[model samples]
Target: MLLFQKLYSRIYKYSKMLFLLQIIVIVLTFISLDHEAIAELPYTSVVLPVHKHTDASKPLYSAEVMTSFIDWQYMRENFLIDIDATIIWHDCSLLWNKNQGDCPTNSCNYPVTCEEYPCTDIRTSSSYKNRYCPPKTNWSTLPVWGLCTCPVNVVNPVTVSCVQVSLNYDNFRFNESNGRNVYTGWDDVYPHAACAPSSSLQSFPANVTGVLALSSSPYALAGYLHKPLKRVLGLCLPSTLSTPGVLFYGSTPYYLLPHSDVDVRSYLSYTPLIKHQNSFGYFIGVNSIVIKKRAVNIPTNATTKISTTEPYTILRTDIYNPVVRRFLKVTKRIPPAKPFPPFGVCFSTSTKGTQVGLRVPDIEFSFPDGKQWTTSTANSIKQVTKDVACLALVDGGAASEPAIIIGTFQMEDNFLVLDLEKSAFGFSSSLLRKKTSCSNFNLTLVNSYV
Candidate 1:
């Protein structure tokens, strides 16, 4: 019996040791696999938030650079967008074929067709040359001070000052959510896009494309960055919590910023874009502003027209200043802290017995499409100094003007998607866990794929 007991004790001890060994092997294997898995997925993007202690930082400038790749790569072929014009020539006998009655070679019997004096269409089927230079006889038509010539030969000239030729055109094509191509739908022909970065802005601007004339949204730069392979451009903006902002073009947005499981596409609440004359950027309607459960009245004429009873705010408008002024007057009940420079209304919890952020009212954004989003105090309020927090909003211009700009600060902690294919703007609340920085944003990608 004693021998049996000894044998049983030895076997039990060995079994316990084996179990622990297995657990150790499993843990190490998982650790190895986790890193290997990340390595295999080379294109997952990790972004950090951009932040400032003094004032709101410029994220648009950064975004502008990233999107320019589209112009540099894809928009090169879209240089010349066609418009309406005609091969018009007035008779001056400037050349031989234009010789009406003044040709040394009587072989030139071209008709003299001038629209102002109703020339006979009897020669309509002919090369009608109006005095290429108004005839010395028609001095009263003296406005013909300069010489005229069609640089290119026109074989078929109609008797009119203008002609209709529908080809590539110069117009802003804002992409709607449907990914519809505004250009001609046959055989995939898009308008040519051109911009001259080197040319100084001036009269007789070398860049006739008008694209290079002025920098505008989705046009000058942001509109250009479509991935050759992905055919998509993605923007990962840092949340107020300090996540990093990333502009993804020609690269995959494999992982959402600050988290891996959260897919930006899933959280989207879409608002169809308003087809305003301005196609420089995505335009949407703003209904009203609600603060702490109260509807804050938007000043009259906040938008060009009333989208609803509330003045609408569009994306990237310079309306921050006006809305802010009203915000200051309404939030007087909250104990005021020392105002920060440029940004006036501030709140502080570090006033001797107070917190660094206290008495700050929550800000809510209500849109014309019934989409409402509220900002956490972290987004609405920002730290300026060690002991001071100020309203992150900027105050601009007189309230008399319609100003309802939804700036980047207001967009903090939001996953904003600017889908050029759809010609629409969409965003959703970002689940933020921490403050991130762009200083060490390392992008991992497969060497085979850019």
Candidate 2:
């Protein structure tokens, strides 16, 4: 009787163990199924707001972007994004924490193969050597490089040094959008492969933990979108740090909310994008420069690059002298104030103010397509102090490659689009001219919709 009772007890214990194991398998399968479902979502495009971090503690000179990342447990965080048009890699320094509790995500499993889209192109790129040069740090610590697990190298725009790190596939969520408007309440999840620095980043804002690469590379942040999405990147920079702007990836007809009748795309003027042999920066052919409708003699080799890093438009000395001279000639009646350190020309703020900006002559650039992009006082004049305002143009030593660089201050409240598929650039001279601004995109409406 004692032997029979012991056999029954063993049988019951084994049955319970088998049931528990089955439950675990079912749960694991469900998680896999959930991720697969998200991957197959039909959304084709995404949009994100670009804001200046209002928090004084995290003062970043560059524009701030917002993005969401999801973990295995489905927790998400809107990480601060830095826009980099010159670099190719999307970097995330937020995962530097060694503690698993901080991330709570599945560890990186997929090793970026050299044969992959970006890796292959990066290795063969003209700028590959200069762009991906590793820092002069410890090289012995690098892992044995191989096809299954080689690290992807990237240059830090801030430090101008490079670091190699492995790529990890993380779930990212974005508000899906049609070209014109966004679907405010919907959150679409997509897997994006990003490299996380093994160490903390230096010289970056405290809250800025990631970079959104807007370069023309196939691996730009928008390039990660599903195959069906159009390869277009649109930007509207806000005039003030307190107001938010918008960044979108998709076909155009972008509408700033509350004014849905007007498509910002309608304001865009097209110019062919000039491709540089070894540079990732967006270059455009500038046929001529005109100040106040009077043409300035610019070198035939002169080109213009659109940049977010430079705060003011930079002109080579030769170009600067001629352009500045012409501008002064046009506005000679306006009394010149003490020259600002970086800016050669300055005027008293006592000058009459227009709705757009301080009354000043316009600077225009004629493109190869025979079209011109005009900048009036709104973009050309920067008020330094209550007493003085300066021309927003800087001198970029005569030897600089791209003769003119259009910077952030000049881009404010202007709509710019880079259509990769078309290899074309589009510009909306100024949104304020249309009685609207980049900040007109109503975040309040977005919040209510959410």
Candidate 3:
């Protein structure tokens, strides 16, 4: 009996040791697989929060640069953004140099040589006029005015002036997002852009260092980052200064959290995004304008375009007159106030206010395919004072080619996706009506996919 007991104890101990060895092998395999998965993961998308601020004169939308060239401490510095701009540019005069005692070791700015790819390629664009001039070997030669030494000269969309600047390439960082949560920073791509003098930034808001172009041009911000983004761009313009909206590069189900599993794209209505050969602006075909569900005749020849530079929509007199007449007729019951400059009609808001500004009638834009893009009273009317509100539409006097230019005010709180692949402009009219706003995107959520 003692011999049998000893044999049993020995067998049991061996079996126990073998079981632990199997557990160790399984755990080692799992760890190896986890490391490989992490190594295989490459960043797919870029996201930035679009900040809104009012200068002395008007509101401006901007984003900060996340790059190795700029000191992280000065991260508050930003770039003004224009959806119609054809190229990205920065004012280089006041940049921190490495020789400066306060400059960070990672921060340094330098221009690319004229012999480089982008600078060489700049000569090919007819718009640039081949203004690229290499640096003179001799110092005695008279400096040529309006010539680009190492970069190129391009027209500034905001000021409508020409800017001569140095060309630079840098790794621009963007925050990665899985729609539900922001993951990590991605900086693998190095895109080249122009750097102009600080004088080029006149009239821009203070602390704005550059301009980011979101136009359809091949050299625009979206094009340079297209490989990872898949030629998709999404923008949500915030209505207030306190809450910032978001700008993203990539395809989307656009999960703005708190509304779990809900995709904002599903709420969007798509229209064919038309590109004009002579213009960089985004245009769409509008069949007519309807006031209070009544169709107002719009000139068939007139074009409609969207703009972020313009604060309010501008309508050519021909289109404006008829629409305003119809609107005035509909709201004649409310007492008409004195005319405000630019705004042709005004009303006294002695009546109790509602969610959509004095409960005014909704204005609808009927499209070519019988689809409609409607704006509630919240967008159509602006309350300038406590007791007064004005019709936000401005008359552009008859010559404007685009009979209607929809501006940023009307676009606020709306989700817009410019899908280059589909060549479609998708819009979600007003997120406010859906009990959310552009500011609803949750930045603090921990992504399980991460």
Candidate 4:
């Protein structure tokens, strides 16, 4: 047993000596390696001097390079070289402890979690797979959104101006037709036809002496008369006869009444052969008439009777007298004016017997010479001869046959006042009644001289 003990002690002592030898050797080797590494490093001092920079002018080592060097040194000395030593050098500063949680071992170390770092969970954190880094701050510096939404295309707007005139013939015709017939000596003509202008006959031929009336009525008294006159002149007279002369009582012979604002009142009468269409035929016989102005009220103070004077002009002379004269000259006395052998008067009753009543066509008269007047300019009368000289030439005479004057006539005293209120408020028939009632008039004169 003693021998065994002695042997164990020797072995223990030998082991201790060997351990000391190993420690000395390790220290020497470490010193030698460190010295060699230092010697092997390029001389920053020499490089500085070559570049003509002093040690103070040389750039210092960067923190990243220093940290990398220190980490490599620690890993080599503590882990790779010392195989038996369990001590490990860990860079806790490099590891993220807040994101990775506590280190797995006491010797293990981790980095801290920065607020900018995108950590999934500190308790059970994960490594960044995409290596994405969050922005250091919020994006409050950006400009406002949605500022450019309007389209850049489309068009714009523009302006313009336009003038017009209207006339009423009913009033004009009525007024003219109702004028006094001084030559005929009829205060009002018989059958009242002489008192009204015939719509069928227009102008009397130039040679015949007769009273001519001008109307402002729209029924076209002159135009109506003209239509039949065209036929009559063609049938009854030679083509060589000159166009008939025209006379106007208040204005120039050619002056036609304007239709606007004229008062119209008249009635119509005719035989059965005179339809509305053929009614105009009735105006043919008396185209040539001396249009004269007769004083409505004869003044006792006047030295001379108001003779033909200003504002009264003869428009045309009657051609019917010459035709009759020619016929009488040939036959020794006037022949009947109708139903000649060649063309018998073909009377049509289809629209016949339609009669229209009307007032005299309105006349504008010159205020009687040297006399004061209270009425409107339209109502004043000037002498017919002074106003128009053409009246002096016409030859007045008796009718060849007892001529039947066909025209509309109205009551000399009654004037139509259009009751607009009645027109608007009353029944439609009331208006029709007024229209019909105002359309015609009739008067009879015996042995009336033309």
Q: lDDT rank, highest first?
A: 3, 2, 1, 4
Structural RMSD, model 1? 24.0
What are the RMSD figures for all models against the true structure? 24.0, 10.8, 10.7, 58.2
In terms of lDDT, which candidate is strongest? 3
**Cα lDDT tens digits for candidate 1, 1-450:** 999999999999999999999999999999899778646643332121222211212222122111111322312111111001112211111222432354353212222223312222212323222323222122112123332211211111112122111111122222111110111211111222221222211211122212121112322333332223232444444443333344443224434435444345666676655543422334456666776566755544455221111111232224554456566666776666788864666765565665544545666767777886666565667677767777776554454223555555555455555455564556664335233322223333213332
Candidate 3, RMSD to the unseen true structure: 10.7
lDDT of 3 at 2: 100
Clash count for candidate 4 is 98
Clashes of each: 36, 0, 0, 98
Number of the top TM-score candidate: 3
TM-score of each: 0.46, 0.75, 0.79, 0.12
lDDT of each: 0.38, 0.66, 0.73, 0.20
lDDT score of model 3? 0.73
Colliding residue pairs in candidate 2: none
Model 2 lDDT tens row, 145-227: 42343355566545656666555444455666654555644444333345556353545554555556677665566656665
Candidate 4 vs. truth: CA RMSD? 58.2
